[model samples]
Target: MSSMKDAREATFIGRRTDGTRIRRPLSPHLQVYDMVQITSGLSVLNRATGIAWTVGSAFLVWWLMAAASGPQALAKAQWFFSSFLGILVLAGMTAVAWFHTFAGIRHLMWDAGHGFDLPSTWKTGKAVMVATGVATVLTWLIALISW
Candidate 1:
């Protein structure tokens, strides 16, 4: 009786009382992790930029289609793109694009078995960040000047 009581008191980890084993959340808390700032932060930023780039590309395609449709459609698209809010959004998209491009090149270097050492890895990561910022600024500056 004591043994049976103990068994009943203990947690039965797998399966329900009805006997079908299935996956379920066994705990209320989520699994958390700590990512390295220089490395993991860059990786996460890269992924985010990639997603942003895809969305930006879709918008660009829409703009192109608008142009192809007719002059009225093109004018509407241009008006939206020239608005203050639109310019801000375009700036953000440009920054994300630069960051993604630089990070991608860094990843390619990694694939080529370069910059694998801790020191080189950190250096390259920092370089990629600086390059992204510089590229973004230069791109915006050129756009403003040309316009």
Candidate 2:
């Protein structure tokens, strides 16, 4: 029994406080703990927008398949996408995707030793948001007239 206990403890080398292993803190970390309201809001917004875009890509795929399938299929898809609300949702998703993409590029730049300063980080973040809107609007308008 003592040998069994030693073997188990040896494999579990992490430090624990009160009978449980302590978890190391996450970085640029999760917002659920010891974080301010504004930071947490951004954190949640980032994640929610991510999920929305992921699911929303399915809509784009659906539209593409509809187009490939022929007029009747395309027509049905067009009817839905052409609706005001659906168009708005699509536009929103476009914006979110663009923002995520640009932000990812910004992170990549940081990993390569660029955009590490406060000014650059803020600039890149703001640019991600602004550029996404501009680019998404351009895309939505182009798509709207494409049938």
Local distance difference test scores for all models: 0.84, 0.73
Give stretches of model 1 more than 4 Å off.
1-36
- Candidate 2: 10-residue stretch with minimal lDDT: 1-10
lDDT of 1 by residue, 26-116 (tens): 4542245346579888988999899989988877987999989999998898898889988987999999998998999999999999989
Give TM per candidate. Answer: 0.76, 0.64
* Model 2: per-residue Cα lDDT over 44-96, one tens digit each: 55677789888898998999999999999999998887798877877788788
Top candidate on lDDT is 1
How far residue 38's Cα lies from its native spot in candidate 2, in Å, is 8.9
| Residue 78 miss distance in model 2 (angstroms) | 0.5
Candidate 2 segments exceeding 4 Å error: 1-46, 141-147
